[model samples]
Target: MKWESDPEDFSPSATIVPFDPPLPLLRAPMKAGLGDRPSAGSFVLAFKDAASWRSAFRATESKILEQCELAELAGFSLARQ
Candidate 1:
């Protein structure tokens, strides 16, 4: 399955690690890293079926758009500050 993340929310401290087991595995960190620092705990995603994989991709797309909106709002807020 394909994976995506929001650029605005991305942190250098975050890491995306993919593993191939009986199924495909993808993991992301829960927090951002300091410059060049490694990530800590990871959130994991496992895909065992085609339908589920497609669903995950769609969800990621929606999430990206949502994140963009949030980032825009945050930027506007910061500018006002």
Candidate 2:
């Protein structure tokens, strides 16, 4: 989750807006297989076609499962405290 190198005047046609085409490298390797504890939260979302990039990756996995179910129902209503 930390690969930087993409600036050099980074011209994706000066900031992507209507630039349709050039984003296809979906790597999938973090399922408890690279350092074992990081299960998710890695990121990247670029789109223009393929059905709006699969509906923007299912609306970003349904908004990260609706914000982890509203932060586990606000931490179970503050642990019923």
Candidate 3:
């Protein structure tokens, strides 16, 4: 409950918002030879719209849970074929 503000903590209404000029990539590959290193990177955890927002959030949460479960399993020995 680290994020809990109170016993009756409630979240304010939120709507999907668009990026004004589109979020810039932290790092992108330069075209051919502009002198920059050839690298391609992206920023995850972004949603397109309301539906996308919901689905992405749920998917991320599930992935996190799955990873946690895997970590827990790592603490014990497993059967092999």
Best by TM-score: 1
lDDT of 3 at 42: 32
In model 2, state the lDDT of residue 42: 53
Clashes of each: 1, 0, 0
Give all TM-scores, in the order shown. Answer: 0.37, 0.27, 0.36
lDDT against the true structure, per candidate, is: 0.65, 0.66, 0.57
The whole-model C-alpha lDDT of candidate 3 against the native structure comes to 0.57
- The lowest-lDDT stretch of 10 consecutive residues in candidate 1 is 36-45
In candidate 3, which residue ranges exceed 4 Å CA deviation? 1-46, 78-81
The CA lDDT at 30 in model 3 is 31
- Whose TM-score is higher: candidate 2's or candidate 3's? 3
Worst 10 residues of 3 by lDDT: 40-49
lDDT of 3 by residue, 1-81 (tens): 588656454534243455578754333333444444446323323334577667667978999999999977875545431
Rank candidates by TM-score, best first: 1, 3, 2
